[model samples]
Structure formats: C-alpha cells, structure tokens
Target: LKDALIGMDLVIIPAGVPHKHGLTKDDLFNINVGIVKTLCEAIAKCCPKAIVNVLSNPVNSTVLITAEVFKRVGTYDPKRLLGVTMLDVVRANMFVAEVLGVDLRYVDVPIIGGHVGITILPLLSQIKPPCSFTLKRSEYPSSTILTS
Candidate 1:
C-alpha cells in the first residue's frame, strides 16, 4: 500500500463493504471504519501531500475518521481531504428529471450536508431551470432519499 501510494498526487478511496438490502450505513461502521483508518494511515505516511477524496460508505463518519488519522500522523490538511457525495447529487438530478418530464441533462440539483439518510438534504429551491412537482406518498413509498 505504501509503495503504491508513493508520490501520488490524488487518492480517491472507495474502499469498504458495499451496502446491501436490509443493511444500514451504521451496520457498515465497524467493518468500514477499520478499512478507512488503515488506508488513511498508509496515505498519511506514503503521500501526505496528496489530495484524498473518500468515497467509502458512512462518509459522514469516515471523513472524520480520516481526518483523525491524518492528525495523529501530523499530516492533517483540511483543504486536502474531501468526502465524495456526488452520488446524492446524481440521484437528485435523475429523480427531478423523471418528475419534470425533462431531459436529465437539463436538470441540476445541488445536494448539501453529510452523505447519509436524512442528512443528505437536496436544496430543491436552488435547482437550476426551476420547476416543481407534487409527489404522492403512494407513488413513492420507499423512504430512501439517496442511494449509490
């Protein structure tokens, strides 16, 4: 791992146990956190100057954990660490396009906050080419607002 990360300019980590049916993000914490910690430690030692984009599950927590690991190694740099939440943005765009009967490319949704259930808030009011739609509860029964 150290050899692989040597002189790296950017490291995008998507390492973790994938989510499955009936599995919550919290359920992945134990397994994924360790994986993130181990990888962050290696990155800190091998490529401390590299920009790290974390794509692991439980990103809200994993990002924090990554920061802590870097801090422990005396290599923490806030500007250099990022949590990837693009999946949330993409999902919002697709759903909005579906509801509006518009081309997906024309829809733009900006999702903010942490990448997790409820925490993943889409700023519907800020959508470009603004439009509105009423969602009937029966038509969208699932509570999952975001999926990757």
Candidate 2:
C-alpha cells in the first residue's frame, strides 16, 4: 500500500465487506471502522495530504471514523476527507430525469437529512428544469417530503 500511495493526490477507499446474514448494523460499523483506521493510518504515513474519499458502506458513520483517525495523526482536514455517499442523489436524479423525459445530465436533485429510503428530504421543489408536479403523501414513502 505504501509504495502504491506514493505521490497520490486523491485516494478513493471502498473498504469493508458487504452486510452478511446475522451480522448486526453495529457489528458492521465496527468491522468497517477497523478497516478504515488501518487505511487512514497508512495514508497519514504515506501521503498525509492526499484527499481521501471514503466509499465504504454505512458511509455517514465511516466518515466520522475517518475524521477521528486523521485527527489522531494530526492530519485531519474536514475538506479533504469526504464521504462519497450520494447514491440516493444519483437515484433521485435518474428518476426525476426519467419522469421529466430530460437528459440525466441536466437533472440535479438535492437531498437533505438522511439517505434515501431512510429520512432524506429531497428538495424536489429545487430540482433543475423546474417541472411542476403534485406530490401526494401516498405517492412516496413517509421518509420523503415535498415543499413549495
């Protein structure tokens, strides 16, 4: 890892294994934390300034773990350590584009709060191209919200 990380300006770590049967969410968090810690230590030693983009699952928590690791090594930079946990946003864009019959590239949907299917509130009112639609509560899950 050391040799490969030399002079790296950016590092995308898709660490940790998939959720398995019988393993709890807490268990997964612990396992992924350990993996991220080891990788962060290596980054601190090998390429302290490299921007680390964490792609691990349970990303919201893993991102905090990465911040702690970097803090310990005195290399913590909030801006440099990012969690690439935007799958929900991607899906949102896709669906919006499909419904609007526009190019996906032109669709931009901003989600707030929790992740998709969790508690995220997609600001559909702010979606690009600004299509008008009536969003009834029954149309989407309770987790999603619509605002004028």
Candidate 3:
C-alpha cells in the first residue's frame, strides 16, 4: 500500500461493501468503518499530504471516522479530507429531470439532509430550472416525497 501511494497527490478510498438488502445500518457501518479505517491509516502513514476523498458506504459516518483516524496519527487536514456525496446529488438531479420531463443536463436539484430513508430531502424550492413541487405533483409515483 505504501509503495502504491507514494508521490500521490490525491487518494480516493472507496473500499467497502456495497449496501445490500436485509443488512442493518449498524451492520453496514461496522463492516465498512473497519475497511475505511485501515485504508485511512495507510494513507496517513504513506501519503499524508494527499487530498483524501472518503467514498465508502455510510460515508456520512465513515468520513467522520476518518478524521479521527488521521488526527490520531497526526495527519488530519480538514480542508484536504472530504466525504463524497456526488452519487446522491446525481441521483437527485436525474430523478428530478425524469419527473419534470426536462433534459437531464438542465436539472440541478441540490440534495440536503442525510442519504438514508426519512433523512433524504431534495430542496425543491431551490431547483435551478425553477421548477415547483407542490403537494398536487406529489401524487405522481416519480414525484413521491422522499421524506414525510
């Protein structure tokens, strides 16, 4: 790992199990946290200066965990460490485009809140194309509310 990471300017650690059906959040967190921790430890030791993008599952949690790990080894840099949420953002964009019958390239819905059920929220009020999302539109299957 050290040799592979030498002279690296950026490191994206996406090592983790994919979210599977029937797996509890706790189970996913436990398994993926360990994987992220190991990779982070290696990065901290081998390429401390590299910008680290944590893309593991439960990223909202694993990214926080990574900060602690880097801090433990004296390599924490808040500016250089980031949790990748582009997947959720893209999903929100695509979903919104498909529902509004707009071109996918023109959709720009920023996703707020966490990535899990009951926590995910699309800021419809802030839609880039200025699309409105009223309760009446919520009747459509594609426009189903992500949260109550």
Question: Which candidate leads in TM-score?
Answer: 3
1 versus 3: better TM-score goes to: 3
Tell how far residue 47 is off in model 1, in angstroms. 1.3
lDDT value, candidate 2, whole model: 0.79
Per-model root-mean-square deviation over C-alphas: 2.4, 4.2, 2.3
Report the C-alpha lDDT of model 3 over 1-148, residue by residue, as the tens digit: 8899888989998889986898887998999999999888889888999999989977789999999999999999999998887777787787778778899898888888786676777787898899787676645675443431
lDDT of 3 at 108: 88
Clash count, one per candidate:
0, 0, 0
Give model 2's TM-score versus the native structure: 0.76
- Report lDDT (CA) for all predictions: 0.84, 0.79, 0.83
lDDT minimum window of 10 residues, candidate 3: 139-148
- Candidate 1 local lDDT, residue 80: 99
- Model 3 sits at a Cα RMSD from the real structure of 2.3
lDDT of 1 by residue, 101-141 (tens): 68999889998897766677878788887866455731453
The TM-score values for the models, in the order shown, are 0.87, 0.76, 0.88
lDDT of candidate 2 over 85-129, digit per residue (tens): 577778777777766679999989888875434566778789998
